[model samples]
Target: MTDEIKVPDAGTADKAKLTVAILVVIAGVAGYYVLAGRPAWLRWTPVAGSLALAALVLAFSRYGREFRQFVELARVELRKIVWPNRQETGMTTLVVFIFVVVAGIFFWLLDLGLAWATKLITGQGS
Candidate 1:
């Protein structure tokens, strides 16, 4: 039998907290727009404060914990990547450019041949 992982359902409180967190962020954006006539600093303050509080609330939820773990895993995997150097990148780019040029020339010749054949058959053009 294959092992399957089942995610547990979030508790009621966790769901409520997540909802509140989302609402807090939405309220922050709305407040920012609503305070457009006020000073820039004052307009931004609600957005900044509400976002911080939302983040705090989300951090206490199970989904947030899972998200943090996923981010950590992604960071670890990113470190294992072997990025190509400048010379290799340049050579690859040059090869692709050459291939594209050759392909374009080949297609152009094919199109000219087809047009000549069609004109000869239909007697339409010199």
Candidate 2:
């Protein structure tokens, strides 16, 4: 039997994603603290420095190569997408408008029926 080939870059790719996720969370928390009244001198400088460090690490890691490959894959996938032209976009917009109007009419009718039924049941017409 012939040997099976396997994609070997997934581990490095996962590591890169994990690193990015950690960096994002750290940055978010730092921004939140700064917004919640932390001293400016204590906030922005350190956050900026940490972000720079993260960028440097990301650029130097083996995972960075994997990340580049992932980006290339995404680029290819985006190229395969079919976007709507102006006419198709306008038609879709019109269809959405029609659906919204129909839904509004349906809901209005339901509300009126409920109001009438309640009035009849309680002998209090408004």
**TM-score per candidate:** 0.67, 0.63
What are the per-residue Cα lDDT tens digits for candidate 1 across 97-125? 99999999999999999999999999998
Q: What is the per-residue lDDT of model 2 for residues 19-113, given as tens digits with 9 covering 90 to 100? A: 88568659855775766666776667656766676766675566667788999999999999999999999999999999999999999999999
lDDT of 2 at 53: 67
Clashes of each: 0, 0
Candidate whose TM-score is highest: 1
User: Model 2 has how many clashing residue pairs?
Assistant: 0
Query: For model 2, which pairs clash?
Result: none
Shift of residue 41 alpha carbon in model 1, Å: 11
